[model samples]
Target: MFRGLSAFPLTPVDEDGVDLTAYAALVARLAGAGVDSIGALGSTGGYAYLTREQRARVAEAAVDAASGTPVMVGIGALRTRDVLALAEDAQNAGAAAVLLAPLTYQPLGDDEVFGLYEDVTHHLSVPLCVYDNPATTHVRFSDELHARIAALPHIGSVKIPGVPTGAEDRVAALRALLPASVALGVSGDWTAVRGLNSGCDVWYSVLGGTFPRTALALTRAAQSGHADHANDLSDALEPLWALFRRHGSLRVMAAAASHLGLTGEVNLPRPLRGLDAEQRREVVAVLDALGLDE
Candidate 1:
């Protein structure tokens, strides 16, 4: 049961490979910050960009550094076999749960998506978090499909991405549709307060990994019904969120981490470049304005 906030830590990479030292330190920071769980190899972690071996090493490092905090490893892949292989690897590495997104080259239909999760859930003892991220996967789960997945054995939670307009109604509808056992989490830090206050059980946050103290404070405020405080905190982080929207969180986060001296210059896998100097300067200004220049 990964309730509250689950921080999705970045997998710092260099010319050599995944930087285990930086990766572990990030995980330790999140665990010590008192987040409910750590999500390794997530979109923030660049799971789709890593080789199988690299992903395994990333999972192992995350679990080891978690220090009793639950670690949920992303096990999404283009193929069913690859997804299962990563899920098995996560289990062997002591991951608490596996998150699955319906990733495919061709557009996937409802039955195909259902079948993919069905096959994976059968082989696992640990719980699965149904990841409905249409932005990346391009496959959205309808309410009916979500209910079908939730009814499957060994499924624990559902992670819904984005906090679209009328999010309260969306949250209320999903809360009514999903089983009480399946907790819904809201991604996209901008929507976290609205989603959490709307009955989502957790915030699957990217900011939480890089700046856990502030993220945790916001979550606590939202959870305790401090709408004004939560709104103030969300407003404070709006500048960084604006950059996240413009340049994408992956690039902005890598730049943010390096700016904070938490990692070396992160070279994401090929075809992805970090922020240009101009964008980096904007990030620096945002970080400094928010007192995150450390």
Candidate 2:
């Protein structure tokens, strides 16, 4: 199973579309920073915006970049058949695992939710992570239901999004209820300092995809019980995240990566827009102050 610090690497795009060279460079940087795995075509990758073929190219690029490290592909669709097809795609592509959320458009009952997972587990042999990104699905994961699903034969982990209200309590409950072997990860890098303090075992940090060395330093500090250092690093990021909070941030993050010389292509699809000039100024100032841009 993919564990420790992982990043959902954005798939780079340009006029030619799906910039493979840029995507590989992004993955190479993440791997060098010691990220455990690469998440391709997740929300960060604009999975909903990509065609099936583009998703395949992104997945192949990620696995190929890792060389030996495991790569995970996000299967973020509502239909059971389609998700299974994506899961099979991940398996064939040599991904370490598949990440998923509840059905889209319709609110699935807990039983139906469970059925989706059960069906997915049966259809695909690879280990899968239950992605409770209620921010995307518009339904929250209940503690009661989480306890019930921890024992399913094929589940390898659970990925709770960073936007969970009262996330401290949420992670605590998971620590209290879930089996020790079923790996638990938090996707909220903005509140990662607090999440680490809450005893969350895995930090699947999205911010690490930007300033990876700093992210690794923060993770190492947290792992070593050096909360003081970790908190300091988190403090350095407060301004950048504030800019991210100022706008619809799916594109802002990709832009932030670009401004740092990661890539100049911030090809965001519709329903999301790039950061305005003011927000970009704020990001640059914050990175400069942190010596991150240096």
Best by lDDT: 1
What does candidate 1 score on TM? Answer: 0.98
Per-prediction RMSD in angstroms?
A: 1.0, 2.2
**lDDT by residue (tens digit), candidate 1, 1-294:** 578889998898765788899999999999998999999988999899899999999999999999999999999999999999999999999999999998889999999999999999999989999988888999989999999999999889999987857889999898888888888999988777888888788899999889888889999988898878988999888898899889988888899998888888765766678899998999999898889864
Listed in order, each prediction's TM-score against the native is 0.98, 0.92
Error of 2 at 232 (Å): 2.0
Least accurate stretch of 10 residues (summed lDDT) in model 2? Answer: 243-252
- Provide the lowest-lDDT 10-residue window in model 1: 264-273
lDDT for every model?
A: 0.89, 0.74
Q: Residue pairs in steric clash, candidate 2?
A: none
